[model samples]
Target chain A: MSSRDAILARIRAAVADAPEPPPVTRDYRTAHVDDDHAAVVDLLAENLADYRARVHRCTEAELPALLARLLTDHGSRSVAVPPGLPTAWLAAAEGAEQHLDDPEQPLTARQLDAIDSVVTGCRIAIAETGTLVLDAGPGQGRRALTLVPDHHVCVVGSADQVVASLPQAVPLLDATRPLTWISGPSATSDIELDRVEGVHGPRTLEVVLVG
Target chain B: MSGTYLGMPAFPQAAKAATRDTRLRANLRHATHTIRDKRARAVGELDDWAVLREAGKRIKDRTLRHLDTYLLQLEEHVTAAGGTVHWAADAAEANRIVADLVQATGETEVVKVKSMATQEIGLNEALAAEGITAYETDLAELIVQLGDDLPSHILVPAIHRNRGEIRDIFAEKMARWGRPAPEGLTDRPADLAEAARLHLREKFLRAKVGVSGANFMIAETGTLVVVESEGNGRMCLTLPETLISVVGIEKVLPTWQDLEVFLQLLPRSSTAERMNPYTTMWTGTSEGDGPRDFHLVLLDNGRTDTLADEVGRQVLRCIRCSACLNVCPVYERAGGHAYGSPYPGPIGAVLTPQLRGTTSAVDASLPFASSLCGACYEVCPVAIDIPEVLVHLREQVAGQPGHRAERAAMQAATWLFEHPAALAAAERAASATRALHPRRLPLGPAKAWTETRDLPQLPAESFRSWWQHHHTEPPTPPEPTS
Candidate 1:
């Protein structure tokens, strides 16, 4: 048997006496389905904001201008762009130096230390949890794009990408893939229970809830 | 014992001993009941709790399915965000990677936030082997470290030790580890905490390297998230010049939006709070703030193996909130040490066996430790259905070829049932021979089962004959027609 087949056989043997697990399916319809995918995205954005994540909404037509404005607002001179980020998003930003370079390729440790902020697209946005998931696809680029930069500006699409519940989300995953789930910016507390922010990931997490 | 449950016998033996400890039973009963009650009230406050729970479970399932893609994406995002990503296949690989990271920093000592991933890898021991000292900053972790004990509970590692035991551990061992407990340390909670703070404070400030584990890692932004009640994690995350995090691959979620679900689920499920006191987030490196160098070690010890099993994969859905531990009757009485791993309680029962592979005597015995009561299912915020997994693991154990004797026993019973005439004859003979039957089986597999439970009293008449004699009246067909 192939490794996968062997694994499956072992699972069968393990659960031989167990009632079988429910079969995977994506057939359940939402009781109150969003009018369209955009409504789902909107709900996701609203819930994200409710969880204290800073949310920004922009149209594809106005994307570049909004991207520039958000960067300028953060007072950033250099921005790390994921390899797969839309070209138009960077087109409007005139003054800032665009960095699509992988830190591993040309940049040394010191060189990467100079860059500020990273912007990319997410794989899925869970509305129920106010979470943004990135599968690091082409437009999403490498994991470093999200980590090395202090400010993370991620784009979320409004249609065909959102799932109402987690049961609706499971069958969509593939185990071998690299998955990252972020609820909010990285944080930790002390012995006295004092709150502190920005330890390792990003101090400020800015989400652009765009269609 | 070298550590918590270090010398304890395999699961069945330890559980048997724990079942008889009246004082231990009282403590576990009181503690678990209180925490479980508080957790329920905390969970009930949320209007969309069921929806949130479903969402959390779904997001985890989806991510695990496409884990390779998400993990690659996470690495890409972290690199893009200006962070270095290292992949470690197992505990040895993870320890080597972390030790190398610390050695690269040229730091002899490292401060740590409470991280189970690190513990699972035995990172501290590994670091010490490299002659690099690791200071545990979390209060409970400090106690465990000073005493050279293994952690039993995920949230409270020292749950097995009462206040008096803590005071003794501190007064006796703290000085050897670092600073001594104040001249006269008392069993008072405040005094113990104060002593720990003084001891850890020096290490936190002097250390050039820090180590941690993230509750969740965002793939989109390459952001690693750590949530804790204590602020020590923040100091370790920031104060050190080099920060290294050893994170399980399963902790990865796809986006920040997905992260929000757990931020809500974790706080209430863990400490029964509307919000955790501290939440630390960082991406890559910041020149002027926190660690200028950041490295994320993605540790995949037994997670991939765990993920491969369809029934067992659900264990990955755990967010490490440890709500199941608070409600488990077995966990409360047996204590975390008896389970013999970092993760104890209901989660430990299913998780440890799968991670370690149910090949060892201890691993094989873990699944049977539970009562098969569904309390864990009801209390689990992520809805892991632990009882179902326990039964599943049990089947796995029983299916092994070594259980041929058991198989033969079952087969004999099956054959007797199939032949009712034989079964009835046997039953009648057994009923007549009841006085001759042994009260308990001789020393062997059935000895434990028969110790407390009594053999059923045989009936004077077999059911077949009793039913045959009692059913003399015929059906009233005329009444039915009317």
Candidate 2:
């Protein structure tokens, strides 16, 4: 028999006498924080900031200027833009060059690294954990875009994109799509268990919350 | 598995040298204590941690009970999703399959995400033997690989090394790999991380093949999850043309929804974060996205044997959170290398002996390494009764051959205890020779035990004899109070 079949058979025989597993009881709270929507968004901002991600709150009209100013502040010479990102987001940043993500002619890793920053919109944001989920959906391009760049300026819609907890966020996501959940900038506690951010992923994550 | 642990002594012998190293002891004590307090606070923040832990345990139990069905389902779905699946019964077969897959790609080098399964099977050594160079991208793993050291902790492999030592390793060894460390690298953690980032970035971009092990394999949708902090996992899982994930069969979760429970438990219990910095999940292959060619190697290497034992089966539920290691007193002192495997601490004590059977002296001694403090069980995210499993494994080890002398002594003591007169006489004889008794034994197993510990002084006389002298006759019964 093939190793697959043999291994399956062994598992079967091993569990032959095992009793049925007890039913799972999920009595845990779905959302650990208050039910108020504004409170949830506030909590999200607070938690995100706590993890050292620069959190910004602005209106849709204010987003373009904020993104531009952030680029200027970080002195990004060029920015990588996802295919579906609104062009206005980069309108104010006249000095920075913009590179769009194209499926047929994708930017190479080296090229992406050379780019000063990546600006993408997230699918959802979890308030309790201060997490942003990118499904490589409309605004968030493939995994490499956010990863290869040194700085990431993610635009999250506060009204529709924010959720209270992981349980609430999990259902909203499509499992079939590749998901990148980012709580903070790429960080590592590998050296003497002290957390030091700015690793292989974006060294700086600037999340812009637009309502 | 790897030559790394070959010719290693038993736990006691290994622990002897480790315990004497005051620097190692301090490093472990500081790291474990820091994480332990943080984990407690993290768990305390949630009101229903117990409920979540139970749910996690039950989900894993349900998956393991019907593992055959789930694994087959996983194979079918993964195949349907534009990926190939291979099954290996042991380490050698798994290594061969990976080597052949990498060879087929015509790639001489592969960038790897830190994976416990690959480490368990010694995949790096296997690849190296086949003339394939595997680069470890995780910072701690890089420290271990560069320093030619074994991983001491599951989460932080280089937990044994302080910042100064890490800086030295990077400065001395980074050039041998690819990029040399910047001139005069300091001992700052940030500087060390930057050095690793600069060193590994080139490899991530140029590598055609990526090797990984998933934290969870959702059989329902055939999606694999790699939970990590650094973007190294992202670089490997995405940028490479070909991706190979060798995961243990026990890592399978029945559905994507099952991740809800574990996703919460793992991050909090592990890094004490509400959520890890990055958690990447992909179902097989995707167009215009991650790796085009994907291979999933389902490894059985002693998992089926572990499952056959009812009391031992619960260990398979471990999520590799490393919480048990942080809370374990024995692990805090003896350090990770003494365990002599990639897995260390309380989980290693129960797991290594089962995975690699108790036939070897090192494996046999692992069961007795713990003090049965139950601290490991208290902090376990899945609530694995680690203490119970340790005792069960101890019984298994003691029953095996080469324990005749210890077993005989136990039986002799039991017999003497059963006979009061003989026990008293033996105690009296011991008391009589108290003046001649040495502080430490000079030879045999007793000597090994007494080498570091002083033998207790014998009493002047047996307690039974003292009681007899105090009251020659039985005292009259006092009036009963109703």
Residue B230 in candidate 2, Cα distance off native in Å: 1.5
lDDT per residue as tens, model 2, B1-482: 23498778888788878888899999989888888888888889899899999999999999999999899889989999999999999999999999999999999999999999999999999999999999999999999999998999999999999998899999999999999999989998898899999999899989999999999999989999999998899999999999999999999999777888999999999998888999999998999998999999999999999999999999999999999999888888889999988999999999988899998888998988888989888889999999999989988877989977567778899999899989988988999999999998898876765664578877887788899998998998999999
Task: Tell me how large the interface RMSD of candidate 2 is.
Answer: 0.7
Model 2, position B463, has a per-residue lDDT of 84
DockQ comparisons of all candidates to the true complex: 0.04, 0.85
Interface RMSD of each: 9.1, 0.7
Leading candidate by TM-score: 2
lDDT of 1 by residue, B137-181 (tens): 887788788778877677777666667778999999988988889
Q: Which sections of candidate 1 miss by over 4 Å?
A: A1-211, B4-8, B404-442, B449-482
TM-score of each: 0.67, 0.95
lDDT computed for candidate 2: 0.91
DockQ of model 1 vs. true complex? 0.04
